[model samples]
Target: MSKSKNESNGGITAYSVKTKTKNVPMIDPVIDIKSGRYIATGKDSEGNKMAAILGKAKAEEHIKNGDAKKGTGWD
Candidate 1:
């Protein structure tokens, strides 16, 4: 058996409403801040867009460590 997309890409898991799938791995994940809340957004394997809310500190860490891209309006 082969590794799943998430395992192969080490992507963050996010719920995908479009695919109706839970724990879907996010592709090209980006971190952004909105209304003082941290958000993680990316695409699923099927190319469906997904997003997950994260904590402020955790999001900042990902940005600072270069684990995720800083999305628009993120400073």
Candidate 2:
């Protein structure tokens, strides 16, 4: 199963089933104070999506493409 939660700002958190063998977190993006929206190439300290200075339309496109998951954080 998966879940999500709302952040302080107008951003969201998401979690989904891991891959075939590993229980690793899925490649999902996260909205931040700066940098804006971005996607995950499966690397980084937080492993969160890379931050991008994209517009609303473009950001939505990422979400639609499943590059970014929408909703809340896990409990």
Candidate 3:
């Protein structure tokens, strides 16, 4: 079986403000467009909310490829 994009990329990572950590792996990430910007939101190991800003092209590509779910009420 082929590995999915997220798997190949080692999954999504976000900086954890609460934990004061960098490159923290995100769980159950979802991509959303907020105020004309692309953003990814999920949880950390301790179930703390985490979010990361993503590039426009990258976000659009992920959405188009069905690798990410379109989030509602993200704005």
Candidate 4:
């Protein structure tokens, strides 16, 4: 199961601490090619998407089609 807490900035960040095969803290993005981690290029305030991005093919695909949004940089 997952849990959620309120954010001070009035935004909601979802984190699921998995304790199965591995203990994963789902807060920061783990930027490794094998891990397939990614970071958002921040939001396009005027619009509803990011500006541009730099990543591998799959990661780039995520920025384009995944449920990616702005988050604290490289946390």
In model 1, the runs with Cα more than 4 Å from the true position are 1-10
- Compared with the true structure, all predictions reach lDDT values of 0.71, 0.37, 0.73, 0.31
Give candidate 2's whole-model lDDT: 0.37
Q: Distance (Å) between predicted and true CA of 31, model 2?
A: 3.9
- Cα-based lDDT at residue 31, candidate 4: 25
Clashing pairs in 4: none
Indicate whether candidate 1 or candidate 4 has the larger TM-score: 1
Sort the candidates on TM-score, descending order: 1, 3, 2, 4
Report the error of model 1 at residue 40, Å. 1.3
lDDT of 1 by residue, 1-75 (tens): 754322223445777887777778777789877888778888887888888887776667666766678887665
* Model 3 vs. true fold: TM: 0.71
Clashing pairs in 3: none
Output the better candidate (1/3) by lDDT: 3
lDDT of 2 by residue, 26-71 (tens): 3445423233433333322354433333345644655665555543
Candidate 2 differs from the real structure by a C-alpha RMSD in angstroms, to one decimal, of 11.9
Worst 10 residues of 2 by lDDT: 1-10
* Candidate 1 pairs with clashing backbones: none
Model 4 bad stretches (over 4 Å): 1-18, 22-55, 70-75
Residue-wise C-alpha lDDT for candidate 3, range 1-75, written one tens digit per residue: 764333336466777899998778777779878788778888988999988787777676666766566796343
Q: Which scores better on lDDT, 3 or 4?
A: 3
Candidate 4: global Cα-lDDT?
0.31
- Ranked by lDDT from best down, the candidates are 3, 1, 2, 4
Sum up the clashes in candidate 4: 0
